[model samples]
Target: MENLPKKVRSKKLNTRVDLTAMVSVSFLLIIFFMVVGELSKPKIMDLSLPHNDDGRISCGPMREGENRSITVILDKNNRLIYYMGLLDSPIIAPKEIQYGKEGIRKELLSRKQNILGYSSRNLKPENIIVIIKPSKKSNFKNLVDILDEMAIAKIETYAIVPEFTPEEYKLLALK
Candidate 1:
């Protein structure tokens, strides 16, 4: 019996795990997510801003003539105040208006038509320039809405001015 090989007993362990399929699935999921993340980037609209670091552009000198500029002041609670020409001598006085097809949009269309008609008579070939002044109380959405309105109106020249004039502040405060 001593010459015969002895039968040894060993503990049975449940460590036989096949991880090849799991590893392959995890890699596939990771690659899929990576590709999806790369493809799902947000589309950004192009905004034309002044090159000045202070975010304010120099007005220089105000020309004395029939003004073809519109100043739209954005305030809190979606309040919009608009004035044509200079604040001192406005072609159209500052008035509060809405944003939709009936409010500022209508005003913009009428003003554009009137200006174009008058300019055509004078043979000056002038176009309206829009100056958008967003106040501290205004939000980003308001700015974007105004920009969309500009695009819908087909405005070619517009400027975003974050700095509010004292008169503009008073105008916003009054309402």
Candidate 2:
């Protein structure tokens, strides 16, 4: 067989992608989401906490250490009554003559601690969310006060809403 001289490869076809348009589109999407996310508030609705294996009331997110949703019920005595689940026992109750803030702070801290477990690590209180549920007759001022206290504790994701059944509720109920 006769050997022919090797020829250099021809110019590549369709090998280059013009990223400029794609980059522009990405930037537009980022800008759009930023505008919308900033304008809207995180949906804060009341939810039943759920139960643990021991039949104890579980509040917040079931995963532990992660942000937990909650229900804040205001009883007739102008007292703060909290139940962990749709049917769980009250995990927090306000002390007479004492503000409800203490109870809330304690509960938040406790849940935070419980979630940390034996990992020998913990997250800041800011990452944990407190879903505040005020009764229909609850004073708006009281709700504000509770929110204020939560803020003081560095809880930034606190939500204020009426009752709601989040997907997590059913997931937790089965547990």
Backbone clashes for every candidate come to: 0, 3
Model 1, total clashes: 0
In Å, residue 133's CA in model 1 sits off its true spot by 0.4
- For each candidate, what is the lDDT? 0.80, 0.56
Q: lDDT of model 2 at residue 78?
A: 59
Show the lowest summed lDDT stretch of 10 residues, model 1: 117-126
Q: Flag regions of model 2 displaced more than 4 Å.
A: 1-67, 85-102, 118-125, 164-175
Count: clashes, candidate 2: 3
Which ranges of candidate 1 are over 4 A from the true structure? 1-66, 117-126
- After superposition of all CA atoms, the RMSD between model 1 and the true structure is 9.9
lDDT of 2 by residue, 1-175 (tens): 2687778899878878889999999999999999999889687898755566677886745454222444555433456654443333333322222245556667656665554342222544345556676656668777777777676666667677677455324333332
lDDT of 2 at 74: 45
